[model samples]
Target chain A: MNWILLATIAALLIPIYEAWQDENIWQTMLAFSSIASKTSIMILIVSVLRDDWTLGVVGVIILSVGNAALMLLAHIIRRTNEL
Target chain B: MSEQLYIIPIVLLLPLTGCMLVLQVNPYHALVIRGIFGAIAALVYVLFGAADVALTEALVGTMLSITLYAVAVRSSLSLRVGAIEDQLKAHTARELLSVLRATFSKHHLRLEIVPYTNLLAMQAALRAKEIHCSYVLSEPGGSPSPPGGGSRYDIQTRVSRLYEIMQAEVPPTKAYLRYIDLANPDKSTEVPIPEAMEGKS
Candidate 1:
């Protein structure tokens, strides 16, 4: 279980680096999208390992809410360009 | 704490992204990095057995705050320059526009073009402080030729600070910088936000 968590942490680093290195806003956005989902999924895995129902529920909510936020942010960025 | 070795790495990620956010030169890019920071922070909260804190971090911290900040940054980090409808179509105006855009972006400011029907309306807007700046082709008799010997544009700005920035970066040959001091204290920038809110309410 601990090894699984370490692997997830390793996976998370990929996007953090991408976000730091990419100069384009959209690419940084893609990295943010990746990091948000990855963190929630890691939370879900931890919940399953610890057998915590509350943590699992929170992870599920974050997963869906992250997508909603991405849409809102993308729309705002698009609108700025049109003006 | 051998069983919690993963906690060290997870917690360390917060500072890593924080530094990235701090180092970012662009406002829009910094906003995206902020979202990344919030997501990592929520995960850390969950690891510390703070489930409700994690939920709040995700909903309000990451979701609501980033969207609000994005809109705020987009609107605030902009420079609006008014030009006459006829002036914008000219070759030299377009050249000056490109130069202005490049100069402003280095300071993380976006340049926006507001076209007006005529010089009278454009000057009115500038006097009312409706626009931050305006430009018009210089008349040969009105102003001497720049050393480069091409037609020049006058970049009139009410902002003293903006005049300084433009003065430092924009070439003298492309445009002449003029700072307009609004003598009427009542009509200057101080009152518009509250006045508009009062009108709406």
Candidate 2:
């Protein structure tokens, strides 16, 4: 598979997925995910074009689990600091 | 040359080449030489529209290389002092005999141990040598005998030279030890004396 093309397709489709969610809360979620999705797609393209299998696997993991962990950590830290 | 794009790789390799060259030179020369090369690289980067990278290289390269040079000079000077100390430490009986044997094998003048092989012993040996210098390990705890003991005129001259070399190379703290002339002076020398002996004399 052409990884650059796949990455380009993913970058385009993510916005559509965000758009399908409700206009209020989902809009905020979409805005946040958009940054993660863009970074992931860029890393994915670089990894595949460079033929770096480790980077390709790690980039996918970061795009999935790393983004979730970052968001969760940010939320917890913010709430604790507020208290 | 449509392949002018290869210039990017060449430009990136300049710092790596500079680093290798600096590593091979005497550390004292590394700072000034590296800074000059780095400045040329910065200028090249600016001409090629990498002003941001150029600015970073100019500031960091100049400051870091100069700092490294200063540290290297200080460390080399300290090492010289440490070498002298090691020679002195070997003046104990067993080592003294070994050193005397070695000296005889290599030198034209015969080596001799005069008086006692203590700090005062150094003065005697230095004076005793007509064609070569003598080595003495200053004994710990004894009061220092006067400077011109055995051959005052000859020993004084050699001691003065040794002191000059030591003063120039050693750091301030270690330099003070060379000034004492006594076997056990004070704790002023960066070389630590035992706590029990500190206030005794």
Score candidate 2 by lDDT. 0.40
In model 2, the fraction of reference contacts reproduced equals 0.00
User: Can you write out model 2's per-residue Cα lDDT over B88-157, one digit (the tens) per residue?
Assistant: 4342333434433443323222233333334454544444543123333333334332233311011122
Cα displacement (Å) at residue B177, model 1: 1.4
- Residue B146 in model 1: shift from native, Å? 3.9
Docking class of 1: medium
**Superposition error at B175 for model 2 (Å):** 22
Candidate 2 docking quality: incorrect, acceptable, medium or high: incorrect
Query: Would you estimate the TM-scores of all the predictions?
Result: 0.89, 0.27
lDDT of 1 at A17: 92
Which candidate has the highest DockQ of all?
1
> Tens digit of lDDT per residue, candidate 1, span B142-163?
6555655688887888888888
| Candidate of highest TM-score | 1
